[model samples]
Target: MSAFDDNPFAESAGVNPFNDPAVTQVTNSTVESVDQYNPFPATNLASQTTPASSSPYQPAVLQPSSEPTPQATATAAQANLLRQQEELERKAAELDRREQELQGRSSTGKENNWPPLPKSFPIKPCFYQDFSEEIPTEYQRVCKMMYYLWMFNCVTLFLNMLACLAYFTTSSTYGVDFGLSILWLILFAPCSFLCWYRPVYKAFKTDSSFSFFFFFFVFFCQVVIFIIQAVGIPRWGNSGWIAAFSVIKLSKAVCAIMFIVAILFTICAVMSIILLKMVHGMYRRTGASFHKAQQEFSQGIFTNKTFQSAAAGAASSAAQGAFQANN
Candidate 1:
């Protein structure tokens, strides 16, 4: 064998594949292309060489200077609790301030000449409800419900008038019923409002014994009126179920109207009964009594502006008469 053919690898080509010029050229080109695409040219490995210990990517383990003692932990908890306590105190103070504002408004209603209407408005707001908002939280809902009952009563009374007027086309006796209903509406509308509703409102507002007693007494009468109206006795202004069904054959339309009116009256009666029970339960808890009411009445009378003026005049006159008698 010849000297070149003595080695097996030298048979085809006497060159190493890894050390070939083409392979070295391709590797050098790939590295240059990667360097061209790098965004941070100044931070390239060729420009800056850093030791592994001083590298930018370092995994640091933070160690606290000292362990927390029990005293330190307790102090931290106490500080947090104190912050929470201060927050609660701030909230309670805000609530108290709001309560004081409400009570101040209640006491100064007469002083403020209440309803505080806007002077800019051309027309006055209806039915100046000065004391309505002063009702206690417990009774506010029930009081409004009672007012709705009154409205219902008024509507039913009006419908009863129409029904009775219609029934009059068949007979003359129903005319009396219609007239009485008109009178009943006229009297009860204002009287009931002044008697029970206003008193209950004021009772809750001022916690006045007189107002409580007055409400209980007048509302008792109101409850009786409701019962009587619901009964629909003959000659009564109310067109109750009995009276409506009794006159059904005469006029179906009138009967239907009367039936609706009767149902409303019945509902009013049932509601009145329920409300009376609830109100009485509340009143008993208020510690109101007849004696307390009398005292409040006397105090209220003595505090009246007219009564005070008359009392001053009487005292002045008595002093003058005594001076003349001494002279």
Candidate 2:
């Protein structure tokens, strides 16, 4: 102490505390203790969570691409999707049934087998027809027959005029004959013209079965009467049957000409019968039978490409709207 006391620093402490090798270790321990004992939550948390050599917050590793958590959510969503799909399918089936019923009802009396009837129009009353397709072909066939009948009657009128001209021009002898024949031609010309227009008009305006029967009846009887009159018979359709036998004496040439005219009229009558058969066939093909109409309606308009597309589009839009509403 006598030697060391010679210097004041030696008395204070033989060395500087900062220069001591153990001082750094002591300082570090103090810092750690201070952090652990911190009143601040952040400092306490950092001290408790961190390792000596590591950061306070742990860094997560990269996850595998095939994470199963999302799949679990997806599976639950798929179940919901399946339930929605079944509901949509049920609605679609119901819609299809309704459409079939509407189509069937539109065409046939089988409407009773359909769904409930529709109510008032959704839009304005005058906006749309809400119309349906249901035209019976029998009526159309009748119109077509009337058209054909008119055409044929006009053609027959032309032929009748030709016969009259031919009879006058081709005759050999004419004393009082031409004058008598002239009077006969003048009188009957306008009357015979009625055969062309009247029958066609009757067929068009009136579809009475009795009228058709009467036409066939009266016209055929008139033909026989006219034939007797051509032979210069005093009374037609009478007990004077043999009187018409004198047609043989009517200049064999004229007799032959008249017979040819009768043959032409016969051809026209046959043509009308053929046309009647044709129209009847077309009518039958138009599903005139109730069962046939129902079957055709079931498959025809509903299955039409335009209608199918419209139905599909409507269904899609409706489903989309429902999904949006639910969401």
On TM-score, the leading prediction is 1
What lDDT tens digits, residue by residue, belong to model 1 across residues 113-218? 3335786766543333443456677778877877777778778777777776776766897778888888888888778877887787778777888988888889
User: Residue-wise lDDT of candidate 2 within 67-147, one digit each (tens)?
Assistant: 569879899899999999999789778766756655554443454321233555343221111112322334445545544
Query: Which candidate has the highest lDDT of all?
Result: 1
197 in model 2: Cα distance from truth in Å?
6.7
Worst 10 residues of 2 by lDDT: 124-133
Cα lDDT computed for each candidate against the true fold? 0.77, 0.48
TM-score of 2: 0.25
| Clash counts for the predictions, in order | 0, 0
Provide TM-scores for the models: 0.58, 0.25
